[model samples]
Target: MNARIAPPATVALQPDAIIRHARAVIATEAEAIGALEPRIGTDFVEACRLILNCHGRVVVTGMGKSGHVARKIAATLASTGTPSFYVHPGEASHGDLGMIMPQDIVLALSYSGETDEVLFILPTLKREGIPLIAITGKPGSSLARQADVHLDGSISCEACPLGLAPTTSTTAALVLGDALAIALLEARGFTSDDFARSHPAGSLGRRLLLRISDVMHTGDDVPRVAPDVGLTTALVEMTRKHLGMTAVVDADDRLLGVFTDGDLRRALDDVGVDLRGATVTELMTRGPKTIGPDKLAAEAAQLMEKHQIHALLVVDADQRVVGALNIHDLLRARVV
Candidate 1:
């Protein structure tokens, strides 16, 4: 016969109690993370030096909750210029141990510093001459004693009500991992451009790596008209290009001014102006704001926002009209 499962017990809900408990957890974790500031001394420095000097990737390993934190730390290090990856402790004991090399450094995380799976691979790691960095709550544990550099991740107590679940201890380990990644990032002089390269598909990559030339309308797509053209001709060019404006260039295609919808509005408002006889030069705004095609698309967005204009003409260093772009182009590229 199949066994029958018992129903879960019903309890009364209390909003005040729930909020109070959440606030207490936050306070405890904050205190635990704050306490770690003083503990970052010689051992932290040594860990950074070991990873920086190592020719191979930093292999992070842990069990249970520490394993989750280790994965995050490895990702942060990899994205921030330090090459690193996470390996499961239990998996490492099996054939997965072959993934680690002698030149690589091993970073182990365990709250008790005596996890059996993590310890099981220590003998192999030592035999292969791989350097070890250990982070644990217990300073005198076997893992800490055996590590070339041990970072003390001790916490007064966990934020869990039962004090059994990994809470404050996990937070401490995560923060320590971040501290190490950032220190090495600074020591290596990593820049935002370098970070963007690792995240090419992200919005940050689009902003940093995207150039104006990559998004601008070039050649015949860019609306251009001679300065001597009538206002009606410029309007037709603007309508055909759909950029809300047309560049007024000389015979050599060098920018002289820009004729925009705003200028047309002002021309219409002036009863003294003759619409039929007016030339593009008479209505054009002289010395309009422009950008080089080599400039970043982000910079073009900044310029447009600062000037309260919707469009820009891309030019060469010698003032030759090369391309054109508007806020809509940036929006389509998701750079705005």
Candidate 2:
């Protein structure tokens, strides 16, 4: 008699309740974001002006989902020329607050405006006289009242079925933070080059920062065989240079043609081998893929990848060979 009688069997959902719940959540949050555009006020402008003029870094902090948004905002600000870093509000009391200087601006985030971890640092912020920008749902909450500039992140209602979770509120807060960062970014006139400077470790950074001169093998290091040179010597030059190809140039260093490992293989595979009788002039390819010395290494990489070639002859404006480069060089220089 565990329950005195058997429990009623539950019916299967016709389509499924979970999908309906998820779609409703997305719809509500999308509407919340749509509402935020017209609500931006003078306080938002002031926040941007303050951050733009701050000589010190922007310190972003929050709790839970807001903390995740704070970290992204900090990254966006840093990449867009506004120096910034994220601090965990909970960790601030554990000595991480030392990262913040009095000169810095602190951006605090809370949903209901009563997040304990965020409020924990209010005393230190006040004692240091640090300027604060707050993002919260409730205007009258302690965190909002204490903030020098309070950004309204209120939403009509959360997407949760019970209207209890932080769905729509978090979306509004994140979008608002992005808007602030983008406004400051535009005001600062940040450029792609400036962004590359901040992100020097990635492939995109290499494309922006690398130039032809950085990866080219110049002067004597260039493997060049004279047009009149025998094919045997040309093969020796190609092998010694290790660039998978050798340039055929005249005494004036004007390019004649290029001979590669592929060319050598083709030459051997020929129906009739004319080794001793042939010269590099007859065996090499004339007018190969050539790049200017001042061109970006990224441009050279594009050309090579497009043609499926491994090397290029670096020439001056007059088309005279000044240097040479290969995909290997690009790989080593991180320009590929």
Candidate 3:
């Protein structure tokens, strides 16, 4: 017969006590992080200098909770122009140590500075002449002593009520990791465009890298008509293109003005105006706001917002209408 396991007992939920404890945890973690600011001194500068001069990747390794923080640090470093990757210390003993090269730098994290798995790989790294940077709460521990540069991530206590879990300590280590990544990013003169390249699938990438030419309606897709075209004909082009606006161009395709739905509305409001006999130039806004095809789509969005207009004509150096885009196009491209 199969044995039945008894369900665990449940404690009564206490809203007031729960909220108080949560706030205490936040205060503890925040204090621990705040303490780290003044500690950023010579050691932190040396760490950044080593990483900036590293010819190979920053191989981050740790055990347990420290390993989790190590992974995040590696990712942050990789995305912020610092080439880095996380290596499991335990796996390093099982031939994964081959992943570490002589030219690379090893960044090890351990709160106690005595994590066996991380310590187990220290000799190998040393034998290969690879530099080590250690972050540990215990300054005198073996890991810290062996490191070429040691970063102290010490905290007075963990935020955990039982004081056994990695709480405030991990927060300190993570924040330290972030500081390192950002400092290196600034040192390298990494720009938003550089960051966007590393994150091409994200919204930030689209905003920074996407150009007006990449999303604009080009060639025949652009709704363009002669300045002499009647308002009715211009309306037909606008409706067909579904851009809510049409560009009025001369015989040489030079943009002269733009006729939008707002213009059409005002024309209808004018009792003296005759839509049947009105030419596009008569109703169009002359010298409409324009953007270059090579400009960022985000810049175009900014221009539209600043001018309180919904559409813009993409012009060339010679003022020729090469493309067009409206607010809807920006939305479709997810650039707005």
TM-score order of candidates, top first: 1, 3, 2
Please, what are the lDDT tens digits per residue for candidate 2 over residues 1-336? 475778899978766677787788889899999988887989999898888778899999989989998999898888888889999998999999999999999999998899999998899999998999999999999999999999999999988778887789988998998998789878988887888888888888888988898889987889998888788898899888889889898888888889998888888888686978788887788778899987889999999989999899898877788999999889998886
Writing each residue's lDDT as its tens digit, candidate 1 over 1-336 gives: 999999989999999999999999999999999999999899999999999999999999999999999999999999999999999999988888999999999999999999999999999999999999999999999999999999999999999999999999999999999999999999999999999999988999999999999999999999999988998899999999999999999999999999999999999999999999999999999999999999999999999999999999999999999999999999999997
Q: What is the C-alpha RMSD of each candidate to the true structure, in Å?
A: 1.5, 4.8, 1.4
Runs with alpha carbons beyond 4 Å of true place in candidate 3: 1-5
What local lDDT does model 3 show for residue 97?
98
Which clashing pairs does model 1 show?
none
Residue 199 miss distance in model 3 (angstroms): 0.9
Backbone clashes under 3 angstroms, per model: 0, 0, 0
Relative to the true structure, candidate 3 has a C-alpha RMSD (angstroms) of: 1.4
| lDDT scores in order | 0.96, 0.89, 0.95
Which prediction has more favorable TM-score, 2 or 3?
A: 3
Clashes, model 1: 0
Return the clash pairs for model 3, or none: none
lDDT (tens digit, per residue) of candidate 3 on 1-336: 999999989999999999999999999999999999999999999999999999999999999999999999999999999999999999999999999999899999999999999999999999999999999999999999999999999999999989999999999999999999999999999999999999987889999999999999998889999988898899899999888999998899998899999999999999999878889889999988999999999999999999999988999999999999989888988987
